[model samples]
Target: MTLLTKLKKSNINRSEYLFLENKLAFLTTEVVENKYRNSKLVIGLLGFVSIGLVLVVLWMQRKRKGLPIVGLSRQERNIQGLILQGKSNKEIANELFISISTVKTHITNIYSKLHVSGREELLQKLQN
Candidate 1:
């Protein structure tokens, strides 16, 4: 009762039937390939959008907290906090188990990032 069955029962030539069968196979393959490609594209887009949303939420949270220093490294922030608590370079180095020179270097970087020349100015900047 199908079209192919009716065609086979009719006076269709052998070559014509073969051609129609091959064309149908090719169209089916093309449709499956298109669907596969579209699914991959949709999945990739969703991943990209999810990452963007997470980054936006993190930025908003940081902004809401009113952070004073924006670009300080973790180590630098730790040094800044120690400095705020009136810890000297040698004491900070002893507590953190780092060399005094390394502690000094982190302090220098912190000062540069905060645009403060020394600890006093850094404290003043953070307080206000």
Candidate 2:
């Protein structure tokens, strides 16, 4: 009824039959391996594409908002916003639970990114 049954019933030499059986097993194993490899490749590509899409969407949204400090990290952006609201570095440090020096560091990074010399210039730049 099956291929193997027919082979067994046929008048084939033992060596030839054994060779054919081994070849069939080898082919089956190859097919399974190929399928596994293909699925892994597909999954990897999908993950890469999904990450790229998310980044693009975020960039588009940020651009649409016309945020002045586009290049600032989230922490730096928070510092800049607080500065705009007339909060001193010490207040920002207390509110954000960071050291005063850490707040100063974020402010410096924000100033460097926004090309502002000080809080006054930063305020002027963002207000316009």
Candidate 3:
């Protein structure tokens, strides 16, 4: 047994034993200045959990909306991509083998879904 263990086993007064317990705690914690190691681990764990929770929330939100906006459908996204490349609607229609009227209809739908007034607004929305 250790010396401290032996002292504890002795019939010392209860008050002295209590004082010794306090001294040991202080020595191993406050005096040594190493108690923060456990606290740091706890803080790091909490940070990781917080980040994970935030990512999960973001993922669920994204899943709830297949696309961020109603206008950003597959066809609209493709058409917009071509438009941003400076392709005219007719050229886009020819490239996609869609009719000119089909292209115009898609354009109108895209504008309505995007809540845009015209091509300028579409460009602005894409820029941001």
Best by TM-score: 2
List TM-score per model, in order: 0.47, 0.49, 0.45
Q: Rank the candidates by lDDT, best first.
A: 1, 2, 3
Give me the runs in candidate 1 sitting further than 4 Å from their true place: 1-6, 67-127
Q: Write the per-residue lDDT of candidate 2 for residues 30-78, one digit (tens) a residue.
A: 9999999999999999999999999999999877655455778889888
Clashing pairs in 3: none
Model 1 has an lDDT value of: 0.89
Residue-pair clashes per candidate? 0, 0, 0
Residue pairs with clashing backbones, model 2: none
**Candidate 2 off by > 4 Å:** 67-128
- lDDT of candidate 1 over 26-114, digit per residue (tens): 99899999999999999999999999999999999877555455988989889999999999999999999999999999998988777
* Model 3 Cα lDDT, one tens digit per residue, 43-114: 999999999999999999877554336536788788878878889989999999999898888888887776
lDDT of 2: 0.88
- C-alpha local distance difference test of each model: 0.89, 0.88, 0.81
Tell how far residue 61 is off in model 3, in angstroms: 17
